[model samples]
Target: MARLRVFLHSRLVLSGLLAVTLLAGYLVFRYFYEVAGDFPFSQEMLLVFIGAIATVLITALLLIQQTDLELRKEGQVLLLDRKAQIYNALIDHIGEIVEKGRLDPAALADLRVLNHKLAMVASAEVIDRFSDVLARLDTAGHDVLVDEAERREIMRAVAVLTYWMRRDLLGRIDTEDEEAVLAAIKANNADLE
Candidate 1:
């Protein structure tokens, strides 16, 4: 898509330059051919020439506006992509912690980095959801070694955290993208099942 935008912008610029070049060439030809002295200072001819130049300028302006709109849309898509990638990484980390039923300081640090990125880019509701998840993780992480029941308790806590986060985050994505994120989350969760 970026390549397409670059190509389109270049084409418009070339077209505008070609139009201006043609207008200049015609004006030079007029000065030397038939309008050298017969009407070198004719106001009527000058007005017509200026009008033609104005038309070219208006066309160029329109092309630039089109390019600007395309670039803005491209930027929006890039931002969305960044947000999605960060969210996915966070979801993956949470799934790992849930399935393993344990987390070290290093793993917790990595998850925090992921959470920070999402907090910065996601909507307010999504940020709140992540905050809830972080709080739960902090609470469950106090005891690293325990029995099966305790491990299951930790798993339950992690599940609740990620479920709410995914729910809120899905609301912000488009329909098609929401499905993709959900499918990825499901795939990541299958390891636990």
Candidate 2:
């Protein structure tokens, strides 16, 4: 299947097909001319030849354009799915830390790995925000203790970062939606500091 797709998309293949088509068209015209011997070529025959060429060209262009569009869409969906999985992993790590009220060594290591993956796929803004939060958490130390307030703050930051990452992955988020997400985050906890 893959090889067939490659062949279908190849410029060499297209050129070859076009050459065959033109050759076949010329052969048909030659056959008619021979059969008509001494009779001049009619305008109808010329029109038929022109029409066949136009049809072939138009069909080829449209097929190529459609195939390109479909391939691009598939690539985008795959990227979004990968980003979502990384975001979910980060969220799960945050949840674990919040529940335990302390960052375990294993959780810290997992968060670091997840953050690295996120960096690969996330937009600049998301990477900056997520990295900032992660840096702060790391500075606080692996066995760092967190009170209720601090834990909630950390959770809120992670939540907001996750939301932004998802919105960015899905495509543009309008100003209104951005404001709403910010408001929701603030409402959940005074601020996502």
Candidate 3:
């Protein structure tokens, strides 16, 4: 936001600023020439040298800005990749539970460890949803969801959790978007029930 207010963001302001700078430089040269006696051959060459130095400085600044932008983009891509891997690990864990037809003590411990990994990359909302899933399993008397109603409820919870995970990975979904998601989930969960 602060960057958006810079002189470069406004072409007219930048042009006017450069024009003023050039005019001031010319006036200074005229003053020095008149006060000293002769005009600038030696000094004119000096001015040209200074101008070349200024051009080099400007080029370096531009290169630095470009490099900064590229590095920031790369960092974002790397973070996105990390987040995707963690999310995939979560889904894979669920697949393991489904295949085994039970969530044992070791499986629960693995889930807690996964939650720790999730904390490093997941949105706060996702972390909360996952914790809720853990809490639900904690209360179940059996190793698996043995009742149809309990199974359907767990499935709904998982679906809602997945929805939040998708939104988290994709980035930037506000409350209105959230309301829409919840509505869709509600409609679908009703069918499950």
Candidate 4:
């Protein structure tokens, strides 16, 4: 999958570059052949070339925008999967922490397995999101862990993640199941923290 993604992206970039190079060559030929001997600076050719370049630029921008949107959508899907796995792990951990939790020995083993899966997913998601957030923070020249304002900003980042999870997972869950998960999460306050 990763290789395929890279191949597709490289293909798009190669195509775009090829297109712009062709456009540039066309403009150079049209200018020299049509206007070089006849006129010093033909406004008509200039406008035409400008329009062509603008069109190519707009197309490239739109394609890049679409790629960015698709990537964001994929990231959201990955994050949702991670959150679900994490929530399950939290549930199992809570069961272990609680009295009369109803989970059998085999269930405990399953919970440990869930935690492993959760760790993999969560690590990937965190690495991606953290890279993004840190880039933003760095660009803004904001200290990541210094002032109260920065702390609030970080909290907002966390809230956004939770909101995404709520929309993707909790919203789709049946009412009772949703409530149960919320209850479990609430009971295990340390899980989210």
Candidate 5:
């Protein structure tokens, strides 16, 4: 049933139908010419046949283009959903560290896994921002004391990373926008401290 539906909806099937219709029309015209002998083919009949064929072919092309666009849109939505999941996981990991006041062994491991996933699914800009956050965390080390300034910097990095991921998920990130987001993160952190 699925195969039948696919075949019916295929562009190749439409092309085949157009070819068959043209062939059948040509055969019918020929048969009438042969049977009627001296009867001439009317220009009106020829025009009607051409017009009908044009209409069918144009309709088929439009349907095919529309189907292609719909499939692309569906695929993009799925991709964005996956990216959102990754972003959420990253945020949760960051939240855990912020709440705990130090990165633990388990959190570091989870961050590593999330970082790898981000590399696989995230945009270059997002990955770069995330990498900076990861670098800061690594420098601080597991169970190490983080000064207030260092903690604030880490928070700022995570905030900037979240902003980049959100922009990417919404398909609105620009080249200069990262700096703006980072600056906003810095300003917000200042207000908090």
Candidate 6:
């Protein structure tokens, strides 16, 4: 069944089948008109019928194409929603830690769970950037009060992660470094600090 669908979807196969069908149809019409000479319908009527069939086929093809596009768009929307939820959760969790200016055992555990969720949907760039957060936490050690310098580093790393997440959610291929975005975010966060 899958092979049949693949065969039907192949442009080369479809075009070849179309050529064969048209050839066979022409031969049948020729046989009826020339050999038997008992063509029931007038040539003008035959042309009209052919034109109507062509119109119907074209309409059906257009509808099928439109349906395929709609389905693709819907799938993208669903994926985008899922990604947004995951990204939001990650951001919120980090925000909570930053707000408290400290970490806890529970937050660390929650972060591990979020990591699994991120692994499922996050782009490589997002995952890589997010890992910096984990590394910073590890460097600071667990269940400790965050110092100003440590907090700034975390904010900068979160900014980088946020930048990558934005690109990933937008379906953009992110290859550039996030240093410039991180610097800007760091400067902004300095005022808030």
Against the reference, the lDDT scores of all candidates come to 0.67, 0.74, 0.71, 0.55, 0.79, 0.76
Steric clash pairs (candidate 1):
none
Model 3: residues >4 Å from true position, as ranges?
1-40, 141-147, 185-193
- Tens-digit lDDT track for model 4 on 56-163? 766776776678679878998887777786855544353342333233555446645654655565545443443443343443333222343443443345344343
For model 1, how many clashes? 0
User: Per-prediction TM-score, please?
Assistant: 0.56, 0.72, 0.70, 0.41, 0.70, 0.76
Which ranges of candidate 4 are over 4 A from the true structure?
1-50, 101-103, 123-193
Q: List, residue by residue over 1-193, the lDDT tens digit for candidate 1.
A: 8867776777677677767766876676566556456655564666577677667767766777787788888988887778778877886887677667777887889987887788778777667666766666666677853345554544455454455566654456577876676566555655564
Candidate 1: 10-residue stretch with minimal lDDT: 145-154
User: Superposing all C-alpha atoms, what RMSD in Å does each candidate have to the true structure?
Assistant: 8.6, 4.9, 6.6, 15.7, 5.0, 3.9
What's the CA error at residue 81 for candidate 5, in Å? 1.6
- Residue 52 error, candidate 3, Å: 1.5
Tens digit per residue, CA lDDT, model 5, 2-97: 744674568676787778877777777777667766656554476488668868887987887787678778989998899999899898888778
Clash pairs for candidate 6: none
Ten contiguous residues with the weakest lDDT in model 3: 3-12
The true-versus-predicted C-alpha distance at residue 67 of model 5, in Å, is 3.0
For model 4 the local lDDT of residue 42 reads: 64
Q: Give one digit per residue, the lDDT tens place, for model 2 in 1-193.
A: 7744774667467767777777776776677677776666553575587578758876886787687778878989998899888877877877787778777788788887887898788898788779767765765445487677667657667767766776777677688987897778667665434
> Can you tell me which runs of candidate 2 are displaced by over 4 Å?
1-43, 189-193
Candidate 4: C-alpha RMSD after superposition: 15.7
Instruction: Report lDDT (Cα) of residue 179, candidate 3.
Output: 81
